[model samples]
Target: MKKPKPLRQEQILGELNQAPSLRVAELARRLAVSTETIRRDLDELTEQGLLNRTYGGAVRSLGTEPSVTERHTLFVSERERIARAAVPLVKDGRVLMIGSGSTTVHVARRIAVEMKNVTVLTHAFGVATVLAINPTIKVIMLPGDYHASEGATVGAHTVSFLQNFHADYAVLGASGLGQDGPADALIECAAVYQAMVSQAARTVVVADRSKHDRLFPARYAHWRDIDRVVTDAAVGSALAEPFRQFGVGQVLA
Candidate 1:
């Protein structure tokens, strides 16, 4: 009946996202854990640079990303539509490098039902699990340190492992989309995403309308690095012009 440390810490970070800060006593009561256990979790999270510890609790770290569970619940309909639009871009019997994110998971689900005889390389547990439902799809997981918040593997090992093979397409999700390009809140994830883009022939970025004009800590790809962008709405010229100038395809899903 106890939550795993990673899940617990993710929940704590989720709480901070809802509010500016959270007290240890409040979290203990809500999580059904002791104050000491909460403190230990807080200590570990702070050491990992995921949160800022206060006198008796923690605050959201600057530029901290929301947990995958948290992100999965927002823009549900938009993400599905984006996936539906993006999946058709894939042809059969090609290799894909899929990045980890809620939007990318939707893309994977669409791929599972619609495509066959394809090979997928991914660091995301959720993306791999979804694609496994299709017997025709071969899923290869990349090696790295597991990041619980994002439910993905990321580290130098993951980036290095990508050099072994090239992919036909690299499908990625963005924490924020700006003129600078699709960025990620986590540096480790950005590194993996950047490597994926380089190793693939073309790159497709999937993001909802909410991410437009937002900036994050790591800009994984520039406009020239992207082959296509699939989003829910038509952004203004500031964002759209760069895609045009770079000859990147824009899909308004």
Candidate 2:
């Protein structure tokens, strides 16, 4: 049998736009090529600033906005690892607040199954549904203007609701993290995340390694505001140091 050719630049970009983060092995399988060929394609994409290379995969550039389903498929293992690391933080009778994102949804699902006597407050409709289905858990929905793409509430209504309530912990997700601060792809989402940060006693950021060092347009919280960041092993030492300098704790899974 003959070896198949690697994906061309256009095909790779198309795949990335559809699914932001993808491992070399997976891409090779999907494109019917060797892992080495996928690696070379990733290198080329990274050089073009179309993607950012991680330990085992590449994430689409910061400016590229992938759909929610696209994000859910990207970095699946890393997100699951982050969720596993975050699950332990939930305690009985504690009010948990979670943001809207793929990783946070996983964390919510784990909490629903594993924990008891918990109150989950979220602006995310999908998260609310996930926890609500678990009869053992108490779920609270914050009212706001619905943003269909994010599947969360945003705007003044949601912010106002959050201000009146406090949570023992807040699990947040970000588009990217940098030396200066945490950022999100959309400004409205950033505003809502910042509101959540202020209302929680301990703020935990649930970000996969792919989020590190990638820049976004709007700023939400700085490293100081985050109590801890739970990510995967792909979080490089170079990115971790700057966050530590700001007194943010980190847990690599």
Candidate 3:
């Protein structure tokens, strides 16, 4: 009555290749199957190296860290949804710290369009430029060695610059997330993120569902450092436990 497991796996891989991420819940909903079935398929596919499991979903394995340009095109809808959901965490006239990455870039765009009378401190040139267009938004660019591909600055200069000021809120994005906390593929970027969190009263993470259990080179923030997590979908206990341990509130988009 059902297609073979191999056939279903092939279909799943095909979908993943088209989109950067795939959620097990959505797959189960679409296929009229149980979440357990989808999870088993993902586990098998992950073993075969066709896909790697994420927080609440799976993504194709390219064997290398993706460039910022490459990342912008993937998961556009999810990132947009995350941006819209996380924007309210920012209020007018608040001093905000923004991080680099595709998701954070989208969040910057949303804040630029929707909110006013805010000051933004960021190492990302793109984010500074986007928010600078708003008359009510004051953008402060952090000094550092420029990373062209990342459209941001990193290293000691950026880290040193953050010490000069504090922010009401810091909105960040993560490349990977595990039980230990948020990790970044680039160690240098993680340093900047660490500084961002340190200087803010509240740190909010805007991420998609695709970062769960995924570890990267640099572990940046612990659960205690993150005040909130705004994502596209609800996360399971395995991923949510760390937030609970630290009293980090999870907001599903």
Candidate 4:
């Protein structure tokens, strides 16, 4: 029996809900359909705004695509605590690379308002705009194609430009994580983060419990990239010692 297109689309969404991402080949195999058929379904889903098209795949997009303003409300208290815990780790008068994400933006807000005489290189307009009030902090915005919804600049050009500089620290954020470090849903954002990990002397990943144990399509950094993790107490205990084994200090907020 031939399954209806709507039914197959529903199944695709259902599978994506569990895995968060699906490659074309894998989805095609699972659905028992030709790769071209799956690709056509992905196109329809993406056009309807039910999914976001990625390279060779599609990811579940129900609530993950919210703007920064919307995201700030989702994890209010947790983000506040994470920001406070992260502030102490940052030193004054050092060059830093700040990555995009609501939690990292909070860290930038803390740094901008409290710290003085530090240099920051960042791609997010949200982070830069928040830091604008601080006169002593030097916020250098990285140029690239802008994503208004993401409130940041991301693309090949952003990654290319970051290769020329080095920073004392890179404070990053992620949508998912594991023993391998942080991951992002979008490949372009992940690429820039990978560069951030390389451009800085040290890297610190800041995320709340929501990201714990989740898997994304793009795992940008390795365990070595993360020197410390400032997160909430809700993170799994089993991963605590593993984090420590890599010399990654876990700071629970």
On lDDT, the leading prediction is 1
Candidate 3 displacement at residue 48 in angstroms: 19
How many clashes does each candidate structure show, in the order listed? Answer: 0, 0, 1, 0
Q: Candidate 3: how large is its RMSD?
A: 7.4
lDDT of 3 by residue, 155-248 (tens): 9999999999999999999877778888888888999999999999999998886665566778888888898899877776777788888998
In candidate 3, stretches whose alpha carbon ends up further than 4 angstroms from where it belongs are: 1-64
Question: Candidate 1 on 181-209: residue-level lDDT in tens?
Answer: 88999899999999999999999999887
Q: List the residue pairs that clash in candidate 2.
A: none
Ranking by lDDT: 1, 3, 4, 2
CA error at residue 217 for candidate 4, angstroms: 0.7
Which whole-number lDDT from 0 to 100 does residue 222 have in model 1? 96
Candidate 2 regions off by >4 Å?
1-60
Model 4 ranges off by over 4 Å: 1-65
Question: What lDDT would candidate 1 get against the real structure?
Answer: 0.88
Return the number of clashes found in candidate 2: 0
Write one digit per residue (lDDT tens) for candidate 4, span 153-217.
Answer: 99988999999999989999987776567788777788889999999998988987766766778
Q: What is the C-alpha lDDT of each candidate?
A: 0.88, 0.78, 0.83, 0.82
